[model samples]
Each structure stands twice: as structure tokens, then as C-alpha cells.
Target: MGQREIRACWFGAGVLVGAMAASLCAMRAMARARADVSADLSPEVSPEVSPAALPVEDAARAPSAAPESGADMFEYRGFVVHLFWQALAPARYKAWCDIWEAGAVVQEAGGPPATYPTAAEARMAGGAWARHWIQNNG
Candidate 1:
């Protein structure tokens, strides 16, 4: 095989490995989350946390999706950053981010060519990418 072909083979293999690793991590995280949720909702729950004792806001508020593992909101200095994955063909994902300052989106970063095998991997890498951008540009 020529040099370019060999390089492409290695790159493809690396992507596969990365995706598999991310899938395993995501599965583990999901399992742990399910266990925790089940424990909280168990029939033997404590009195203070019973369903009837839960509080609701007097005013309606817009609902927001809970951040996934590895994509939770993080802050540095005065900026807030959150990572996400952009789906690409053939089950690949690209890392992306929304960076906020003063309660508004200040930047959006990353995407294309499906650099990651899973959303978890994308988010993890995206977080680093965002931090790097913040360090140099923010």
C-alpha cells in the first residue's frame, strides 16, 4: 500500500477504537444513572422526598434538557461553556460547543467530517477545544 493509503487505514482504525471506547463509557454512565434514579424512586423512599412532598414553582418556567454526562455546563472566569455532538453520516459525530458570556452565546465552535465515534467523545474533546479557545481568545 502507498503512504496515503496506509495513513488512511490507521486513521480509520483510530476512529473505530475511539468510538468503541466512547460507547463503553456512555453505556457505563447510563447504567450508573439508571441505578441512581431507580434507588431514588424505590418504594422504600424516605418520607422527606416522597412525591407529594416535592415542590413546584408558583410561576411557569421554560423547561430545559438536562445536560448529558461529559456535556454539563462548566465555567471559567466569567464564561460558561457547554459541549454537544453534531451527527454526521455513517454514525460519526463532531464535537461542538456553545460558549456563553453575560447570559448570551458568545461563540459556537467545532463541527464537520465526523471526527468522533460517539457523542460522549465529541463532548469530552469539545470541552477541551472550548477551553483552549477561551484561553487564547477570551
Candidate 2:
């Protein structure tokens, strides 16, 4: 190629590289701004009130100021379990043993939350479920 053509090719390559770099920088800045906004919006948990420090019974019985969004809490066999509907998959219910002493067990993703007509019946069923889970998985 002629000297002029070579120079034009190099200039084009440099411009392309510069554009790519500018795009990458812009994306990184946008990500950082999004993170900052999320941090500012989310509720901050107090250092004094760790989850382990809170009693399981109190957590189960306590009224949440937060709106009912398909999440439920239950006390079962001295442990508190939280059953909530996943945001992405609203049809499925996710269960978690909230208390540390319960080993913070997360139920299998597809497992359904135990259902009962009364709290007493729920407690009985929950105790059985806990025992079965511990024996098989723990």
C-alpha cells in the first residue's frame, strides 16, 4: 500500500480502539453509579441487632412493618423458619431455617412449604419435617 493509505489505516484503527475504550469506561461508570444508588436505597441493618442475637420465638411472633409480599414466618421445634415466594419465580415457595442453631438450612428449591389449617397443626407438622430433614440431610 502507499504511505498515505497506510497512515489512513492506522488512524482508523486508533479511532476504533479509542471508541472501544470510551465505551468500556462509560459502562464501568454507569455500573458504579447504579451500585451507589442501590446502597443508598436499601435498609441498613444495625450492628447491635445481629440475626443470631434475636430470639427465634420473637422473630416468629413479631409483627413486621414491611408489607405482606407473600412471605411468612413460623416457629417449629424451637426453630424459626421463613417461607417466602421468590421474586423471579412467584409460583414457587422457598424455605429457610432462619435461626443459626437450626444450622441455617435452606430447603431444596422445588420443595413446597408445609401447609396447615392451624398454628398448632403447623407446629406439629414442622417438628416432623425438621426431624426428617435433619435425619436425612444433616
Candidate 3:
């Protein structure tokens, strides 16, 4: 190509690269800001509150004391799907339904825990279950 055409191509490529870089920087800034806001909103736990200091019953009841084999539970609309260990084949994680009243369990559903392979999958199912429960039981 001629010098003028080569310059034009380079200018176009430079503009495209610049635009992409700008967009990426903007996305990162937005993500950082969102993380900061979330950190500010969440209550910070004091380091002094060690698990060993709590009673056995209280430790068992604590959400953070969930078994290492189990994933974290998901909550929605005052309902929670607690994660539990499942030895069953084809499922890695299981969830039990519980009603949360004023941040404490008010009711526990009778039935087997729902099983899923991943925590994210279980969370999605938990959200659906919460929605269904709200519609029918609310």
C-alpha cells in the first residue's frame, strides 16, 4: 500500500486500541468501586470472636461453622437453603430449606435436601425455590 494508506491503517488501528484500553480501564474502575461499596455495606466481624470461645451448640448453629466439605448457603426473601454434605453419587452439594425469622431459623422444612454439583447451581435452584415458596406460602 502507499504511505498515505499505510498511515491511515495505522491511525485506525491506534484508535481501535485506544478505545479498547479506555473501555477496559473504565470497567476495572467500576468493579473496584462496586467492591468498595459492598465492603462498606457488610458488617465487619471482630477478630476477637474466635470459634473456640463460642459454645459447642452455638458454634454448630453458626453459619460460618459450616462443614469444610459443604458449600456456603444462599438466602432470599427471608428463606435460606443451607448447604450440606451429600455422600450420594453424582451430587457434590445438597441444600435444606429453612425459614429465617428475624435472622434466626423459625421453621425447617421436612424432606431430603436438594442436591447439585456446584454451589452456583445450588444457589440458582435455591433462588427458584425461594420464589416458589413466596408465591405459594407467603
Candidate 4:
């Protein structure tokens, strides 16, 4: 091909490389957040940063104070489901979606707020946060 075509090919390659790098960086950050959330699962852990207790969107923007209902807790990839707490008063609490490749939570929604036993499990349940439960106590 001509020099112009060669230059265009290089430019396209550069863009692809850049996108891949960005994706990787995002995945690493998600993994870190997941780790941080798991590591500090103590009474001292601040409620402000906890995923389970996320505050509703700005009140000024909304008309009512009522909590959102039937909202999915998490969403990642194409999976979506509700999470329920089988052993507690508020059986259904929050939801979360797993960005499986990123090793982190892609999204999360309302629930009673409990640290997940495993990151993998939590991620898998993304888009199904309202159905969270202690699958195994071990």
C-alpha cells in the first residue's frame, strides 16, 4: 500500500492499543476496590464508603423520599437478577453486578448491607443484588 495507507494502519493500531490499556487499568482499579471493601469489613468501616449503604440519588432531583423498590442491586455483562437475604428480616436487600473480567463490582443497588463471603460470588451475583444470602457459612 501507499505511505498514507501505512500511516493510517499505524494510527488504527495505536487506538486499539490505547483502548486495551484503558480497559486493563479499569479492571485493576475495580479489583483493588473489591479488595478494599472486603478487607475493611469491620464495625469501624465507614458507612459512607460501604457499597451496601449507598445513599439515594440527590433528593433535589427527585420528587419523593421513598426508597426505590424492586431495584436490581448489581449489573455486569448481560446478567441481571434480584438478591434476597434468606436469614434476615429484610430478606431482599441490595443488588450488584459483576464485571467478571475486571474482578470488581460493575454496579450495586439497595439491600441490608453485608460483606460478601467471596469476591467471585459477589461479582457473579451482579444484577441480582436483592437476592443476596449466606449460601454457605463456612
Candidate 5:
């Protein structure tokens, strides 16, 4: 191949590598943020929580916290999605929140409000939802 062709090929390769690196970095950041949510969910789902705050007894329950104030809050800071079994009598549900930084929670409560499912499931769903927000927004 000629020198010109070789240089062009090298340039293209560089661009591809740069893009891949950026994507990997973003993925790492997102993973870290999701991890924060998981960590925060731990204390929020304990059995000794206030009954007034939780309002539910089953591990499958979801949170009843209201939505975030700003649209940007949901887009940037993340959100809380209440996953209920049914509309009227949601016995057990899951609460999913998305945090921004590695340990930054998007909720006013500093974590997801309250979840009804086992701590594992609540954390899983919350992390999944947070990752979804990051992926979709970016």
C-alpha cells in the first residue's frame, strides 16, 4: 500500500479505538452509579422500617414516593419508578431510583423511597432502571 493509504488507514483505526475507549469509560461510570443505588437500597429495605413510611408488609411491595420535581431531575439525576402488582391494592412492589455520581442518589431521600420485594430484587430492579436511564439519556 502507498504511504498516503497507510496513513489514512491508521487514522481510521485511531478513531475507532477512541470511540471504543469512550464507550467503555461511559459503561464503567454507569456501572459505578448503579452500584451506588444498590448500596443505598440496603438500609432502606430493612424489616424495622417505620410502618408509616413503608405502608406495606410484603417483600414484593413497591414504593409510594412521589415523582421527582424537575424534568431534568429525571433525565439527569435519575428517577423513582414504582412497580406495583396492581393499581388499587399493591401488596408488594419495587422502587427503582437512578443516582448520578458513584455515590450520588437522585432521590430527595438520598435513595429509593421504599421497596416491597426482597432486598436483592429491589436492588436489582433499581440498578437496572438506573442503568436504563443512563443509557437512554446518553
Candidate 6:
């Protein structure tokens, strides 16, 4: 296979691994949350208590503020795109982007292996790649 194809294959594998890790983390978190809720239940408290029985503080709260604006971040087609770059060598950089909707990650788009001498270039590449992905997949 070509170098570009090989890079894409590796990057795709990385994304899959990352997605699995995130799912495992979410599962563990859900289990912990369930345990916490169960521990909060006392022998006197019925498992099927009505909402009216809940204290005023138990009511759902308001949503948080929106994300701040920046050069490497922007909203596109109802999705929040965040761009980031890492220095891989003295004159080489790598970039990736995460797309979010409803405050959760939708996907990660990794930039091509093109030489990026500056962080700005890397971020631009990543953002472009992410936008294209969104156009076809979003």
C-alpha cells in the first residue's frame, strides 16, 4: 500500500482504539453512578418514590454556558469543531480535530501526513479535514 494509505490505516486504527477506550470509560462511569445511587437508597426510602417527594434541591438544574471562541475552534453545521496540534519533531507537527454535538464527542479527524512546519498550518489542515468529513458524514 501507499504511504498515505498506510498512514490512514494506522490513523483509523487509532481512532477505533480510542473509541473503544472511551466506551469502556463510559461503562465504568455508569457502573459507578449506579452504585452511588444504590448506596444513597436507605432501607426506609422506597425505590419508587414520586418526584414530588424529592427535595427542592433534587430538581434538575439549568444547562451550562457555551464554549468560548478561538482561532482553532468553530461551530459548523450544528457541530462544535475543536482543532489541536502537537509538535512531533523540531520542525514537524501533527494535528487532529474533535467534533462535538450536545456536549459530547462525535468524531476525531486526523490530518494527513503532509509536512506542517507551524502549528497554525497543522491546525488548518486538521480543520479542513474535519469539515470535509462532516460534509459527507454529518
Name the weakest run of 10 consecutive residues (lDDT summed) in model 5.
82-91
Give the Å shift of residue 110 in candidate 4: 37
Winner of 1 and 3 under lDDT: 1
| lDDT (Cα atoms) of all candidates against the true structure | 0.61, 0.44, 0.50, 0.39, 0.44, 0.64
CA error at residue 71 for candidate 4, angstroms: 25
RMSD for each of the candidates: 14.1, 18.9, 19.2, 15.8, 15.7, 14.0
Q: Following a full C-alpha superposition, what root-mean-square deviation does model 1 have from the true structure?
A: 14.1
- For 94-122, candidate 6 gives per-residue lDDT tens digits of 77778888755789555566758776677
Question: 53-108 in candidate 4: lDDT tens per residue?
Answer: 44444322222212222222343343343332221122232333222223222333
User: TM-scores of all models?
Assistant: 0.42, 0.31, 0.33, 0.33, 0.32, 0.45
Candidate 4, residue 65: CA error in Å? 19
Task: Output the lDDT of residue 113, model 6.
Answer: 60
Q: State which candidate has the highest lDDT.
A: 6
Pick by TM-score: which candidate is best?
A: 6
Please write out the lDDT profile of model 5 over residues 1-138, one tens digit for every residue.
Answer: 999999888877875885596567546645654554345454557535533666455333332232211111233343333221111122344444434443233332223455544434454455555556556653
Q: Write the per-residue lDDT of candidate 2 for residues 47-121, one digit (tens) a residue.
A: 234445557743433333222123345655554554333222222223323322343334532232754443334
Task: For candidate 3, list the clashing residue pairs, or say none.
Answer: none
Q: Give candidate 1 misplaced runs (Cα > 4 Å).
A: 1-71, 109-114
**Superior candidate under TM-score, 1 versus 3:** 1
- Report lDDT (Cα) of residue 31, candidate 4: 62
Better of 1 and 6 by lDDT: 6
Q: Which residue segments of model 6 deviate by more than 4 Å?
A: 1-71, 113-115
lDDT of 3 by residue, 11-124 (tens): 778758855965675466456545543453323333345556766754433333222133235666665644333223433555445555454444454223467775446555
